[model samples]
Target chain A: MPEGYLRQSPLASLGLAARAATAADAAGVTMGERERVMLVNLRGDGVDRGFLDRVRQALEVDLPAEPNTAAEGTRHRVLWLGPNEWLVVAGEGEQLAAALDAALAGLHVSVTDISDARAVIALSGAQARDVLAKGCPLDLHPRSFGPMRCAQSRLAKVAVLIDQRDDAPSYDLYVLRSQARYLWRWLDDAAREYAVRIIRP
Target chain B: MLLITCPFCGPRDESEFACGGEAHIVRPADPAALTDAQWADYLFMRKNVKGVHFERWMHSHGCRRWFNAARDTVTHQFLAFYKMGEQAPDIAPVSYTARPAPRTDPALPADPALHTDREGAR
Candidate 1:
């Protein structure tokens, strides 16, 4: 095997970027283009302390120390997914997987780039929670999950990470890429109660 | 409802956790030297004690971390919770301890996402 080959994740081929949009629309209205981001799975026989440190050094971002909490920057954000897992999101066109893999190779960890493994759905509107309430049981009220708050919970039968960020009741739902169409249909059906326009990115 | 005391998150509904069965079972030093029956016993058998017992539970829906809990099997009451690698509290032993009857139906709500098999499924 080539010396640097193993250090690169295959998902690096897909560029990742953060998509931001305005939510000036009405109730249940969907504004802003949906953007896709990479979701990487990090695992090892044990916690790799040095690997985490190296990742912070390379990315110039602090890893989220609390579960369900997210750390964001101008171009990237890292969410604490689990004890040995994290979700790294960056702007589209960025080779994040390979960059992260190469940055933490000596730490005895396995990084599987999941850019294509998951789907990203961004919802912003007054009725965002109203739509989510149809499937999710968690309290989506702004007081419970305001900006920077995240939780790994169910969106109907599908597992998802729900991040509530915008004051306009906007939310970002993430699930396996294979379930994209299913979730989209569910969302569309749920949003029908209110006026919603699907914006393409 | 079964209210589990998370070592880190305080008391949370049992729905947030996954039971890891009985804890404190040490592995044999040389597994290769054991007989088939011995290996099978170690791998598949458990006491499933009815009284106070130590068990492992993962806060799958909360911190997404594993910890230990001292629970009364009969009452389904958690006596204490401890993080992984931490020692269980030292409780005095009582000779007259009685096994509490298992609660036939617990009121805890289910957390569907914690049981899903997807990546970052917690």
Candidate 2:
């Protein structure tokens, strides 16, 4: 075994180094690879009242039934992926899947704890949309795909689930763990023109 | 480049979807009762109609749900997009082609890249 070695984060080496963004341009984008986030996947019949109710009871947040919409609670963010599938995101809520699994017992459902299967990347600032538009296909306009709206698409050939967070117009992108480094590189390169500022984890 | 109006996710770029050929092909209730030719016909016979077509499309990269769309093959205009179990609209082909319905974004103004509809149609 190595005497002095430490594990590295998905984007530890590749994240744009943190620096003071100059005021020359409209607030250059700031990006950070969010760590210690919990991601849970839920698959159940959304139309079933019982299923929806139990999920709400488990997470204390209602499941978003509308397509491409996100139900953002202070503690949890529920993103609708399909008629019967959703992704629940939070900050280090390790017991969420177990809670939901216990509560949803005896039903046709699946609650998987996928926190380790993916990494979260946050892109924020005035030029955030422009940075994402370099590879993502979704129309990232404020009017059409505004805040609270979420969509799953391929960003630079890597599948990502994007949530338009705020009018800072921040975006939360969830990518597979295996592709996190590559996607980070793609985003960093895309944001170069806008003078990206990397925030510390 | 087709801007598919997913019944669940609204209109999204065609890049987010995968077109499955020929919707509404049901399996026979009793395959044992069918003749060999009938089984073959059921498996391989899909209308290669050049005009209006009914096909299945999955929002593979988005909601991951599938829906039916009735669209003109030649003009590349979408007539209707409905849920999985819903029936196709009753507009005649004459009206469907004479004045093709505009492709609504289902959310906002159109994106210019969605004009070409014939992708994955080899």
Candidate 3:
């Protein structure tokens, strides 16, 4: 309980800064940690217009109703986890959950701040898809999984939620906090063949 | 690997799914009134059929939603995928009765040479 305590990511002990500095400049894959992103689990009646409208008003973007899709607002990215379940990734802490709670005051919905439950690792570069293809069974072809698409699937045998951030084919792998180190190591080793640059956030 | 089509997430590898045994087993309203045998029958009895089987499957790795599927046990072919609480689709069941009939021929001895009476052997 120190007065000036610092928040550390699960992969903090990996010394990513030291590694990134010495990484080959011509690497095929660049990996980094998005340690400050906040996550919130939102579940409500997807069929209810009122519920949907309230959520849209709160987030300033429509929650993706289609499976495996994501909608990005100015501050949040809403990923559809199921028919009525979504995971909101926000750049700020706790405020998104508060906004959702205020918007859905009397509705039959659940909004939980799950920011500490998972860790997000950013992966992108020319050979990123090939590195993911080594273990994941999902069709990662751009035609199938373009930007703004997200999916919950296994990556290197670890359950992860993959969000394709852009046409650079960048992805954010959301892994359980307990398995973040293991998944990071797996990705590190998997990306070695393609030359990985471990970027620090 | 079998490609299972989740009603919500579409086709995914079988590894991403977990099979929840036989579907549509209703729970009794009053369990206390039922006899022990009746209770056990309701709890343990499962129709492990060989033909068109309706089962519950969860898209564990994908959407993590439970859905129903009609699959042929003999052929490992999925007949249909419907959402949970929905009735099984009415499709002409796959050919499950294609098992070859037992070898029967009048020309063959009633008991093949392999079956020898113990007394005859003595």
Candidate 4:
């Protein structure tokens, strides 16, 4: 197999300088981005066994069927957006899209690369939910929305897709590319109460 | 600040949902046979119920699905939120303040007594 394409991510300005810091170290919330993750929009007949099987073979992940739920595989993560639509998260977006296209050649499905369309910001720490609740209306309580759950809600004035990733009360906010800076600033202001820290991812 | 329950995404703030005016206004099957006045009625007329009403709403910020809803125009209480393909729930147009749970099946009951010409989105 050939090496993957050297596509430019929107956050390329940051240049991927590796660093790590925790909520404890930051005194409260640790805010950062997932950095260059691939986003693929997948739409198909979820009830069709053939389509589901081919999707699994292409991405090595089972398509999540439950509303606001996510399914993970070794190589990919899929979040259920609608009854028949999903957002596929991967590392190599173009390659994955091509592979899915080839694998399900005759299937009635749509696999489009939306990696450039969104920027995934990771907001984690003990008080992350509290920070999110400042403007978001979704029940971000641990008992209501916990790990493996994904929701689409508006943050500030823009629509975003958020999913609870790791259980440090960690959540990933996927906003449109144009709104990334505004949301970043919004989160910064929101997290000010908890003393949030930003680290390169 | 009404909390509308999106059938797919559970209850969400009314801010996240956009009302699509009246619902269940079926287009006449034989449009060519209707007169201009009848066509105007079909296109522009809508029942303005003060108590309970059938409407369409879109969870634009959430799952982005468009579903039907039963709401009281006067009280702004959402009585029922159902999927697009589903039938409108049965309601007796009780006072806006208090209404029992809507019953779903074939069709909702008609209540001409609830007429008032209430205005606003949905």
Candidate 5:
């Protein structure tokens, strides 16, 4: 209630966003026609060596070998979110989470669907970096961070993945869906200094 | 900023992960059996190797797990990342490789109740 918090029913909001974007735009946002991504949460006491290999083979993307890193191909992107967990971004209908679970079926691991647990927002256009610079600390210089580069940092108070795409000066940000309205409002306010446009996809 | 590859979370911003220390140090199994000199060695000593060396890291903000990393002490380039129990993967032969695996053993007994505290700053 502090400032920008859009409090609409989840189902209603979902319908609105879906209606605005075509299927292709939704895919770019990792949401299907339904405007949702199948998020999977994985947990284990320690690193599961065999499971990691299987994930690599299943997603066909190299697991980032460094912290605060991400890797992407034409179809999918795998983000190192924590020591015991990761976030896999795929097309809206892609069964990345299920495939990962199947790959680690017998291993000592726990996987849960978190597709709805977080809110994802894709911010493109030239001013995206300027908007993010308000809260994030990472150097956004193209030379320092380019395609396939990502970082887990805070956007105001929310934990977010700031993934830079191939498009110059555009970025995709993921956070808790519950916090979407707050983040959107914050971003909109931040973008006031520059010419900004907001679209559902 | 330093780019750290968390064994669990993949590569993330250094801000999200915490650096533990040199990865290969083992704790003394029996504190009572060792001479004071040996106990001191276990407590305060570290090679702090230059160039490519193994170190311990935790994904404190995300998955909250600890893993091993091979990083160049000089360039601060991360060479390889592996989970907690497995040995750090062999560095690519072309660039820089770690010396033969140092005698890595659990220096301390596993604490059944010990869990990583995830609230601290990375």
Candidate 6:
């Protein structure tokens, strides 16, 4: 186990395991948490080839050049937050932040380990899109948003980063730690009509 | 719902954006040398145009970047969106031919039901 602080999931008190077992009989929506994952915020000039080359050498994947897109690597996934900023989601035990700091040593860039600032909630299954579309105004159709695509938008009136994980149509919502509970309750209420399963992180 | 296009992130809902008031207002280089009236003018005065207003907007919930946009206040039609430090697009003076003028003609008859001759109707 890692530190005790990192061991506790944000939704620990929600009794999600029991709820998930009850809803397992149906197959509408499956919700889970990916707690204590490493989240690093990286910022550098996208136009600078040198910076891009350094990041690619470090992570073995080119930082996504397009807006609202994500690039997945063997051990890490980079989501584009802005033209010059990205969020690096890596395994909890990885030292990707130190590696990035060394790789971008001389460059005018930023690599901050904001691992605990946000909470990740996974929403999947058939009606996941319907549950999201109920609040988010983005065009979540397959053509507009698919696997590896990411967007920063409001869900249930709270700011969230929506990252589409795969064609299973799964999504990982990165919400501020302070508002994670509110977002969870909102999602639970919204997904009540569907077969809602809450899984452990 | 107004769909404002962020320069970096395509079009997004208006709820994701926050307007930063009128755009292209340069601050004076020498604030200490200016009179109170001049300083107040620069601080308080703003153009409230009826159409084709230039304004600054930030995609607060999205990219968190600021950009400029030209929009028609009357129609709420966004004319163009440009990144910061770029020149605002030059649009031809547009005329509003479809919008009707407010009815102020005295020749039009008033509704009789709206008027009553009964006293103490106050």
Backbone clashes in each candidate structure, one number apiece?
8, 0, 0, 0, 26, 0
**Better model by lDDT: candidate 3 vs candidate 5:** 3
Candidate order by TM-score, decreasing, is: 6, 3, 4, 2, 1, 5
Put down candidate 5 lDDT per residue, A5-107, tens digits, no spaces.
4433333543445445442331112221224555566565335567667776887876665655777756777776654556777765676767877887878
Structural similarity to truth (TM-score) of each candidate: 0.71, 0.84, 0.88, 0.84, 0.55, 0.89
Better of 2 and 3 by DockQ: 3
* Deviation in Å, model 6, residue A126 alpha carbon: 1.0
List of clashing residue pairs for candidate 4: none
Q: Give the C-alpha miss distance for residue A24 in model 5, angstroms.
A: 18
Off by over 4 Å in 2: A1-8, A13-27, B94-122
Cα RMSD for candidate 6?
A: 4.4
Give the per-residue lDDT digits (tens) of candidate 1, residues B32-121. 999999999999999867667889998776667889989877667778888888888875433336665666655754655666756475
- Every candidate's DockQ is 0.20, 0.63, 0.68, 0.61, 0.21, 0.80
Instruction: Tell me which of candidates 5 and 6 scores higher on TM-score.
Output: 6
lDDT of 2 by residue, B1-122 (tens): 77888888778888888999999899999999999999999999999877778999998988888899998888788999998888877857643336657787678746544554545342
lDDT of 3 at A69: 97
Kindly report which residue stretches of model 1 are placed more than 4 angstroms away from their true locations once superposed: A1-25, A29-33, A42-53, A141-144, B1-16, B32-40, B59-64, B91-122
- Alpha-carbon runs more than 4 Å astray in model 5: A1-34, A42-49, B1-122
Model 3 misplacement above 4 A: A1-6, A22-24, B92-122
User: Which residue pairs in candidate 2 have backbone atoms (N, alpha carbon, C) closer than 3 angstroms, thus clashing?
Assistant: none
Question: Which regions of candidate 4 are displaced past 4 Å?
Answer: A1-24, B95-122
Write down the lDDT of every candidate, Cα atoms only: 0.70, 0.83, 0.89, 0.83, 0.66, 0.90
Q: Candidate 2 residues A46-121, lDDT tens each?
A: 9999999888877788999888899977678999888899999987635788888899999999988887778899
| Tens digits of per-residue lDDT for model 6, B1-122 | 99999999998999999999999999999999999999999999999887899999999999999999999988899999999999989986567657778788799777455566443375
Judged by DockQ relative to the true structure, which candidate is superior, 2 or 5?
2
Report the number of the highest-lDDT candidate. 6
Model 3: per-residue Cα lDDT over A1-201, one tens digit each: 112246677888888867774635888999999977889999999999999998888888999988999998988889999999999998844478888898899999999988877999999999999999998989899989989899999988889999998987799999998999999998889999998888865
- At residue A133, what lDDT does model 5 achieve? 77
